[model samples]
Target: MSTNFDEQQWRAELEGHRDHKDDFFATERQSPIPADQRDAFDGLSYFDPDPAYRVEASIDPIDSDDTITMETTVETEQEYERVARLAFELADEERTLVAYSGVTQGGDSLFVPFRDKTTGQQTYGAGRYMEFEVDGEVTAADTVVLDFNLAYHPFCAYNDAFACPLPPEENWLDVPIEAGEKLPDA
Candidate 1:
């Protein structure tokens, strides 16, 4: 696919997504409630969040094809050293914390996977997240996008037999991420 994404194309894709969402719920009979809240399924729904965002654009190294990692410089005198130490440890373990700018909100920011207050209790046990950076064109490490509304579940959510990225601690958000795919029925 071409790297150039025009505004028109993006708009079309968004419209198509809305159409797909309608079709998906029309045929998929499973409601959006846990067994405990069988009656409340009518109230719960996926796509409850709006997609509007404050865009930020920037670039970071691609850690891995499946998992992209972005490195951020911790700026405070005390925090800088602390984060640097953490980065070293992560490198030692071959675990990278890359700032992914492809997903954006509130400005181009890094999107990291994380477990949150909802993990294992209200939402997916693995948890979900969205992130953002300052808004601008992506070049090197200038900025990136982080849209939390897009925090989603892996294919395993649809079926039980797959391993997926259980969101890590750093990726967790204090707020409810009311976007993307919701947990499949248990």
Candidate 2:
């Protein structure tokens, strides 16, 4: 696929998802925003889509069967099966992020939660999340698109009622990711 066309398509899809979430946050009963706060909610903030934030990453599958327990905002721990590590280049620097599968949510999806230098400044303080679907088992040969422009804040960033897993030190990036969702101003 053409790079320009692919980026355009990806951005359009991201905008659509943002609009849907805005609607839910404004009118849905299960919205993370409190009922009283929803009245003043305009929409979530986001950085303008930039193609530079999209990069191709190679998967490095972990051979061990060990599981990682991540701490949550509620002081609880959640277990995830360590599936693979994604290595890519961002901001002219090489970086790696651990990818996981929910221990109970099955292996159909890969979850990547991370914190960047922008975290607690331009983006959510707790961190953001990205998820991808795995077609069979992910291996070293797998090349996937890692798009920071699609990074999104966890629900806990909006309301305290929702508990979100904190990004481990392994997933913290030293570079600022000026893409995707920004912290909502209250």
Candidate 3:
């Protein structure tokens, strides 16, 4: 849905973002890369950035006060508000993903965790995630950008001590998303 787009600018920005993340993983103290491995960590693996994976989705706001307790990687749970459902098409298939507000996690951005057909093989086994901030509040039928190229593995993918919420069953997709971070080198 990204017609009238600037490919050069998008690629440049994406590269910069990846560079910054690599720097953090290689040097930052709060980075997910283990201290012992940081010295040898070159960078995280990623699928080549593809513009096709970036699509505009219509938001279907959940009117009721619905909440869900997501199972985490560390056998704990995290709560989130069912903010909205994002409707979009990927690989010629109608797909929908739930966008959540991590209220219990004290996060300010909209959280979206998902597992595509590529999961467990090409990317993180548990799944990958995307987060974006809405200017005000989500409104039904509002178009929002869903950039799968920005999907990332949670910190728990690199370290088991950090608990990461798993995507809900509804967010699991039958399509393959070949964009985004891939399984870290074992």
Candidate 4:
């Protein structure tokens, strides 16, 4: 049985992850903010929590063994196995996004990279990413909860030292997704 996600709990967890020393947002590490400037770093900026951006999507499994090559900011391509397409509604409009898995290794998690109207203005220009793990095969009968509130910027958005895959054109959304991470101060 699937349980509904508690927004408070999820937000708290994100905060914890950011504050933890070994976590991605750790000030001492590869944070987007320069180490000398990190002393003033509080946390990432985010749009207010809105449940409207959270919706359920049906999985449309891909039958072919097609591979998608996504170009990175560093001019290199990363291969991902196109696993499925997630169809859902956002802002009263029907939309779809392709789901992918690592081409080298099979895992329970799926990666979704996307660009929204908010890209380059309020969020990462290259796009943001969301990932979730599923139990067993992802069939049409499986309804996955897609929470835009969980969307995050790629590591490359912070530091150029990191390489991140850019979102494919197929995954770009015309609508503004005002939830999740916002661009860090310049």
Candidate 3 lDDT tens digits, 8-64: 999999999999999999999999988999999998899999999999998899988
What is candidate 1's lDDT per residue for 83-154, written digit by digit as tens? 100121111232223344332222444445555455565567655544444334333343334444556554
The clash count of every prediction, one per candidate, is 33, 0, 0, 0
> What does candidate 2's lDDT look like per residue over 22-84, in tens digits?
999899999888999999999999898888888888889988886999999999999998888
Model 3 / residue 101 / CA error / Å = 0.6
Candidate ranking (TM-score, best to worst): 3, 2, 4, 1
lDDT (CA) for every model shown?
0.41, 0.86, 0.90, 0.82
Candidate closer to the true structure by lDDT (higher is better), 2 or 3: 3
- Candidate 2 clashes between residue pairs 3 or more apart in a chain or in different chains: none
lDDT of 4 at 18: 42
State the lDDT of candidate 4 residue by residue for 73-181, as single tens digits: 8999999989889999888889999999989868879999999999999998899999987677776347788888779888787678777999999999999999878
Model 3 is weakest, by summed lDDT over 10 consecutive residues, at 133-142
User: Candidate 1: where is the Cα deviation over 4 Å?
Assistant: 1-12, 18-45, 52-111, 129-139, 184-186
List runs of model 4 lying over 4 Å from the truth: 1-24, 27-37
> Which candidate number would show the highest lDDT if scored against the true structure?
3
* Decoy 2 TM-score against native: 0.91
Off by over 4 Å in 2: 1-5
Identify the runs in model 3 with alpha carbons over 4 angstroms from their true place.
Answer: 106-108
